[model samples]
Target: MSEHSIEDVTRVVDGVLRSRRSLRAYRPDAVPRAVLEDILDVASSAPSNSNTQPWRVHALAGAPKQALGAALLAAFRENTLPPSPHFPHPLPEEYAQRQRDFGAVYYRTLGIDVADMPARLRQTEKNFGFFGAPVGLIFTIDRRLAPHSWLDLGLLVQNVMIAASARGLGTCPQVSFARFHPVIAQHLAFTEHELTVCGMSLGYPEHDEPVNRMAMPRRGVREFACFDQFE
Candidate 1:
């Protein structure tokens, strides 16, 4: 039996979802280990097709996180990282446009001009360091799993982000880490059947930072949805 009214639960859940954003900067304070465990426990309940439950998470903190970031950064600097093989090679025009628009707004919010290529590159490089977050997380899946499993994995990832938000933590899911999969594999032991999916940065956001306020606009329901024979 639950004590909360439906309205109360709805308000709290909606607020948690709305408050979540990909934060680019974070405070150095460490999130307690118990809190991280609790977030993951909540996220593990995300639905999966046929109860496959195909999600693997590697949470990094302290020295191990720093070491992995250093290795990846070195690889990035040397241009040794491979292109991400899991994602579609050519994004559709509409999707590309949305990405470009997000980049424009994100950079502008940080006071970075489009002409400043070096600054842009530096900002991109910050992904390797988890944007100064104290916790870094890497996600993986069995290499032989079909695309549907990857779709299922997305549900789990969303759960993780939302659960963290509910607990007053901020998170950024970084696909950029997929480019350095080999570097990560070197640091974290993965069974031969496993494939790196992505990484995430987690911590308390530096709310005072203007860059943390950068939010991309979403398409309206009219733009992205279709109505059936319903009222």
Candidate 2:
């Protein structure tokens, strides 16, 4: 059914995934509507739990995206909202270490000393700005669904990022937006039945930014995977 050999597909797919990084800065140029749509169309092929397709995406750009970002920034500065818990409390040491490692690498790349709270705060604020990306996407799921459905949503999100990456676009998936769910729900006016999942930034990358070059190390397959039946 396909013209390309299996090796061709494997090479291309591997290249795309390896090259994709969570870009924190982007050029101001706007992404065309059709291109955005096409990327999403490709992402629609991601597998869902029993085809539940529990993902709802809100793609924002231009004035609307800016307006939402402004509202989020204001709320962030005021520090009035309740914290949205992302990680488990008293998170196990191993996973926590990985998170710390990520932060160290990320900040080090930008030449920001980890102890510089002010600088870190400012950089954190940029998340609300979608890291200067032109298109900001908000993903949501129905509150009633179980964790399996959320996993399905993540599959969709991964597909979106990979699809965008294949097209020379950059993306960042930010869970910080989940903390301002009320503001987003009011601003975007989505149904209350839905729960905020996460937000993402998508746009043409600004290649000159040093943060764009930061690459976190990943554990080797032998370190993270388990196999028994294979010989």
Candidate 3:
């Protein structure tokens, strides 16, 4: 029975955050079902509006998961985009710029020049296959929920990622999967009322891959934050 100081807890939080990365390549080893459940239980502890906990997750593994990946790939090859239930329009320029920057860095690291559309498409196709991860998770929300609920779901996702890091597991939150939501929902038997927000690939990372070695740069706190009268 030992009590931890605030500093000790903060150190642990920092360690968890440092350990997490968007793991694209993963080892073939299967993550245990119990471990997955425990991580998700920790995620569910995240706060929600009125304690509604509107997040719905569909976790897949083994043959069914593989089948889903295969089907999604087929749809992508056919150049069909899934039906989007609803999403924000006209993303702010700053937000859009950040996204574009990430894409530029990602492609450059992969040695894909801007002229290499085929290579880019192939790289994008890897997402539909979960990047060879054994487990695929689809995060969904009720269509009736407001935009704020999506923020709640995002918190829940962050909890899941951090908890997974604490357990030596790596995760990649893949919004690309949203493009194939109809295929995913149809395969998973989700109702029309449920909208797929995003998907995640969870497993142990393959440390040898150079692509996994790329570290995304982040801005300083002062750059992104503003202090009011306190400053």
Best-fitting candidate, scored by TM-score? 2
* Per-residue lDDT of model 1, residues 41-134, tens digit only: 9999999999999999999999999999999889988996667875566888888888789888988998899789999989999999999999
Candidate 2's C-alpha runs over 4 A off are 229-231
Which parts of model 3 are misplaced by more than 4 Å?
A: 82-92
RMSD of each: 1.3, 1.2, 2.1
Q: Specify the poorest-scoring 10-residue window by lDDT in model 3.
A: 82-91
In model 2, residue pairs whose N, Cα or C atoms come closer than 3 Å (at least 3 residues apart or on different chains), thus clashing, are none
RMSD of 1: 1.3
Query: Can you rank all candidates by TM-score, best first?
Result: 2, 1, 3
For model 2, how does the per-residue alpha-carbon lDDT over 1-231 read when each residue is reduced to its tens digit?
A: 299999999999999999999999999999999999999999989898889888899999999998999999999999999888898877799999999898899889988899999999999999999999999999999999998898999999999999999999999999999999999999999896888999999999987888998877889998978787679
TM-score of each: 0.96, 0.97, 0.92
Best by lDDT: 2
Model 3, range 33-141, lDDT digits (tens) per residue?
9999999998999999899899999999999999999898999899768445443566678878887788888888888996789999999899887898888999999
